[model samples]
Target: MADTFAAIATPLGEGGVGIVRVSGPGSLNIMKVVFKECPDKVEPRHVYYGHALDASGNVIDEMICIYMRAPHTFTGEDVVEFQAHGSNVSLRLIVMSAISAGARIADPGEFTKLAFLNGKLDLSQAEAVIDLIKARSEKPLSIASDQLNGSLGQEIVAIRNNIKDVLAQMAVNIDFPDEDIEQVSCDEFITELKRQNDRLQSLIKSSEFGKIAREGIKIALVGRTNVGKSSLLNGLLGENRAIVTDIPGTTRDTIEESSSIGGYPIVVVDTAGIRDTDDVIEQIGIERSKNEIEEADLVVMVADGSTELAAEDFEIAEHVANKKVMLVINKEDLGMTAAQSDIDKLKSIIGCDTGDIVYTSVKTVKGIGKVRDAIERNLARGFIKSDGGNIVTNERHKDALVRAKAALVHGIELLEMREPLEVAEIEVHDSFQILGEIIGETASEEILDTVFSKFCLGK
Candidate 1:
């Protein structure tokens, strides 16, 4: 790039160290101009201790600076970094000095974008950079690492190559029109396309769990007041995140947190207990609880085993009947006072079976492990049908796969209908182009902007 770009590389805050980074063709000039006492001779990828100087040669901050030459740096361009004391003020001033010399502020994800543009990473791998930054759990982090290491990209490339081979065979039939060659090629194309089609179907199927692993599942804990919803939340999280009390409306607002369970990221929302109440705030909370139930992927219906199901309980059950649900009968330590008929009837209302039920006592923490196991089991059902690695986690990648898969299906259908090889070649070419979009081979500027916009500044 003609213009050098600078930014506060590390997050702005008080820490052990903060870095101001510069990248592009003019990166060295910014370093030489802003870093006072910089040696006449600069070494690529070598650290030098110095002070940042403004236009007047006034010292702004003391720091260790490093410069790396083009083609071997993160952005495949000359890069410089000023590692100073962790203060936003100092980092900003250093960046300002760099800008005054020959640099401008870098945009969000600009560095990674440069890497992608310079052949250092593909589009899917570039996306994983943001995913790695935002991951809150090990599952997503591992998935991101795999993707960044080219797990998904390699798989996509291999599939693209197979499709290319099939297209090459089709080209021979299209040009020659030899009856025997056409027949042989048609049989070969159907066989190979069926294999690739099955792979595409598996990836699309695995995308369900991949979405959960990447974005985390939103679970809403719903039940009538005094049914131990808060207790169950605290138990599930293994911390006193929610304030549990004997008071009817102690938790009058939703409490949300991120955690990991069963190799998946989970966003558990402890919404206020669902109940009909005259209290204005309680009514508002109850309304929010209803909304959470509607939005949640899994509706956890916690019921008290010591008390009979109330009208509100029946109403809550009916509301979540259309969602994926798990029934937790808490307070088992209090003895089974709530009748079997009532519990079974509640399960019937929610359309869940005996296997979906778990009994727990938040006091003694009895059956809490079973509750977690139950949740994991619920998430695991029909989720993994393959080795489980290389699952498609990005929606963009999945969408591309879907479109490519559709084109392949259409081509196969045409061949089966004894259509001309010319017509089938068009579908095959469409499939190739669609697959290329996943790796930015045919991606438009708009697609790149949308993908990189999700990143934080100075990434």
Candidate 2:
């Protein structure tokens, strides 16, 4: 029998309400002892108004409590919850009362772990619960929610089923060598293996976009001094997050802020203008800017449209020549000093054959939308459309898929070489096992511990 586990489910702060959760066989018994005005037999799945009590039967707080019976609860066991005023002290006291009533404090993520162990959720769905909690934007939330709803697990199940069918065919060939059982030909087995391999490849391909959706992309604004980099940052965020001025080198350090474009989260970084400076502090800032450019997912090269291209502009362009770059010609309202010919010359100088160039005036906010669209387009280069399909978002899932793909490829090669069906079966079995790890069907205890340990308590 599992020990009853209790935890303060809400954050340790004041809110509208706080919840103390209990799960296991002893949950209702502990609830009966700790809640005042309790009936001899509590109705399952019904909320009851009551007051929490201490060992001396003194009222701890006015509360509402609910009891859910076994097999239908989060952990497939008896579960209870006490909802009380959102006071940290009161919540802790309530949890202590439950502890005194024979409910032990739960470890981090123990509740969800129990849910996984009890067959209430698969490994993927259990992992999705944490992703849902940590999601920072709607796109990530949507993906996580879909995974929790079993989209990814269903796809994995289908692939595994296909592999199982091939294994079955191989088994028949081995078990009935002299019988008239029709054996699966090498070509047929290879065809099925290749189909599954292609599916896994597609999933692996989606991981990049899924990662961007989950963690957001980092974009660094690079340019010479006084070219409206700060202004463009403000425009993208639709707020004044950076100090803007006509004086050069006003922003000596990088300023980072979070915003979303086209439903995707983005970290916009306003970097110091790239230039040769004698000031020690400015030099440090410029070095940091170079480092930021190196680490950025994309770089926006801001140029002054109101003035002719300078040596510094060319220097900046050359610095970011190999990076994924979008050229923004700011201050277009002031009249164009750098025309298309100048842009062509700048591109030639940078050795970049093609780039997204947007003409904008940060002062008038013209063409800001164009710049945003260009960013979205660049990021979506190889991104697979969602279309209600399973996307591999977690690095663990991607690694497993890669392993599975390699095993399948090896199996196909063996088949093409006319190796014994039994020999190729080993590789196919390995692929199946690798896929099973994704849903915890064959995962080791250590992997389970590592995954669940990242979850917050009471989840």
Candidate 1 wrong stretches, greater than 4 Å = 178-184, 238-241, 252-255, 276-284, 308-315, 344-355, 363-370, 382-386
Compute the lDDT for candidate 2. 0.88
RMSD from true fold, candidate 2: 2.1
Give the per-residue Cα lDDT of candidate 2 at 71: 95
Best-matching candidate per TM-score: 2
**Taking the tens digit of each residue's C-alpha lDDT, what string does model 1 give over 1-459?**
356798888887899899888999998878889889788899998889978886667898889999999999989999998899998887888888888897888998899999999999999999999888888787788888999998888887888899999888777777777555644558778889888888888888878878887788898998878778887788878888988888888889888887777767888998898777889988888788788888898888988887776777788888899999999998888887888888888889898879899887866565778888888888777343347557778899899889989999999999888898889878878888888888888889999999989887788
- lDDT digits (tens) for residues 1-459 of candidate 2: 789989999888889899999999999899999899788989998889989997667899999999999999989999999999999988988888999999899999999999889998889999999888888777888889999988899899899999999999988987898898777788999999999999999888889888888778899999999999998899899998889888999999999998887677888999999999999999999999999999888888999989998889988888888887888888888999886787887777555436477788776655777788878787666333555567778999999999999999999999999998889999999999999999999999998999999988788
CA lDDT of every candidate: 0.85, 0.88
lDDT of 1 at 201: 86
Cα misplacement distance, residue 351 of candidate 1 (Å): 5.1
Q: What are the clashing pairs of model 1? A: none
lDDT of 2 at 320: 89
Q: At residue 411, give the lDDT of candidate 1.
A: 91
